[model samples]
Target: MLRFCPLSRIDGQKTFVIMERKGDKGNGKQTQKRIAPPQYDEAFKAGAIRMVTEQGRPSTEVAKELGICIDTLRSWLKAAGVQAGQADRQNRDSRRTRELEAEVRALRKQQAEKDEVIDVLKKSVGILSRP
Candidate 1:
C-alpha cells in the first residue's frame, strides 16, 4: 500500500505527490531487514570441488559437510566439470584470486615501509644519546 502526502494545500487544493514507504504500518514502519551474503574462500572452494570429483561423493553431501548451500556447491562442480551444467565459475574464481593476491602484496609493502620508518627513528634516538 502506498500512502501519499498532499503536494499543495493552498486554495483548497488537495493533491498527493509524495509516496510513503512500503513498510509504513502504524506510526512509523520498521526498517527492512538486511540479507547477509554467502561467504566463502578460494581454498575452501577448491576443497569442495575436490570432494565431489576425486572422492566421488555427492555434491549435496560435500555442501553439507562444508556448511554451504547445495545449489552453490553444485554450481561450483558444474564449472569445474565434475557434473554437466552450464556456468563459468572458474574464470570468476581466477579473477577473485588475483585480486586477493594483489591486496596481500600491497599490504606487505606498506608494512615494510613502516618498518623502515621505525628503524630510522631508532637510529636517530641512539645518535642523540651521546656520552
Candidate 2:
C-alpha cells in the first residue's frame, strides 16, 4: 500500500503539485516566493499639483482623485514653486513685459518731443500776432 500527499490542484487543470516529505521527524518546508513593490515617480506628484492648481480643483479632491495623500500634493506644489492663492513667480514676468515697458517709454519720449515743438510753434504765432 502506497500513500500520496497532494499539495495543490488548479481548477480544470490536469496537473498535480506534490511536496516531498523530508527530515527524520517527517517535517516538510515549502519554498517562499518574493514579490517586488511598484516604483514611484516624482513627476506624478508634480502632475497632481498642476491638475489641482490649473484646473481649480480642491486639494482634498485632487488628492482623492489621484489616489494620493493631500500632504503629498502639498509637497509637490512646494517643489514646483507654487503657493496657495499666490501666482507662480517663475511665470509672472517675461520678455513681453520688458518689450511693453520699452514701448511705453519710447511713446512718452515721442509725446514730450511733440509737446515741445507745439510750444515753440505757439510762441512764434503769438509773437507774430503781437506786431
Q: Name the best candidate (by lDDT).
A: 1
What tens-digit string does per-residue lDDT give for candidate 1 at 26-73?
646433322244557788888988766655555666778888888888
lDDT of 2 at 83: 70
Model 1 ranges with Cα > 4 A deviation? 1-27, 84-131
The TM-scores of all predictions, comma-separated, are 0.41, 0.34
Task: Give lDDT: candidate 1, residue 59.
Answer: 61
Q: Ten-residue segment with the worst summed lDDT in candidate 1? A: 84-93
lDDT of every model, 2 decimals: 0.67, 0.62
TM-score, structure 1 vs. true? 0.41
**Clash-forming residue pairs, model 2:** none
